[model samples]
Target: MKKLNISVIALAISLVFSTGVMAQGMSKKDYKADKEKIATEYKSAKAGCASLSGNANDICVAEAKGKEKVANAELEASYKPTRKTHYQARVAKAEADYTVANERCDDLAGNAKDVCVKEAKAAKTTAKADAKAQMKTSDANATANEKSTAARSEAKTEAADARKDAATDKLNAGYAVAKEKCDTLAGTAKDNCLNQAKRDFGK
Candidate 1:
């Protein structure tokens, strides 16, 4: 689990670097060569997964596939550098993490499994919400750069709204995870757990 966490972190950091470097634009030749390199790396990763068995193998394969998908998405963003591509790249990373997490949850049973899945989903929701909010904020800021004082004020308002919406989304997802945990309890315990979740999340 620790290893996977570290690997995911490393991949995420690489993605951040790729975004900054790739956004500057790349030659067609360089883009094509990078795509080939990504493909080679993916093949190597998948091959490494083949040595494992059962759920472990499944997890390994999922990680390999997730990395490939994320890499491709990042490459596209680097080549295009559009707001849409950047958003897609972020979504890809979120989904990749969720997939691997859900796969890892297969090692558990009962309420624990359920909680694991819920937590993974909550993480995905939080990531996606943040990504969307970032895109919106970026758009607003860019527009603000080209407009008058009123437009700047409007941009600020839009950015604020975007962040508020993201916070709400993350809060809702947290509540869901908390509620899922509550299912493990009975009667009054469950009721108290749910109430706490609602209060904590402002739900």
Candidate 2:
């Protein structure tokens, strides 16, 4: 599922980059029709979840809603084809996955469920961090292109900083997940787990 989501994101980003100013090719009428189509699909998808119950129903509903949001975000990115819109699309995907994952984690109990939720959150944080870094890099590069050689150097530095920050955020999120998992243990075992996590994540 993660691989599939990554593929979808890759495809969306590719499409977004390939069609610079895609709105120029799409008529307002066409965009409106596409939007309506997306809405109709979402409604149908949500209705399909009615047959399910309990956690199954919850998961189904969350998946339906997530898909709808991701579709809308992707559509908006395609229509506008800007870095910000692309970033928003990526965020929508991350949030959608996080929502579905959290719903799925409902099947677990106690510390296991906590760990699942934390892992899901960590995944979302990582995705968002990467998306933010990409957007910042793109913005900086664009600015550099419009300015002097010094601006190019500055953009490079900014890009590196963005990546470094993203890495830090991802590491911290992973550490949180690891720490939550340690709650399943006790005494020295839990302590050892936490210490290992700290060491692994360079706390």
TM-scores, each model vs. reference? 0.88, 0.88
Candidate 2 per-residue lDDT over residues 67-139, each given as its tens digit: 7788778778878889998999889988888888777777877777787788788888988999999999999
- Give every collision pair in model 1: none
Residue-level error in angstroms, candidate 2, position 18: 18
Which model scores highest in lDDT?
1
lDDT, candidate 2, at 47: 96
Summed over model 1, clashes come to: 0
Candidate 2 wrong stretches, greater than 4 Å: 1-24
Q: List the global CA lDDT of all models.
A: 0.81, 0.79
- Which runs of model 1 end up more than 4 angstroms from their true locations? 1-23
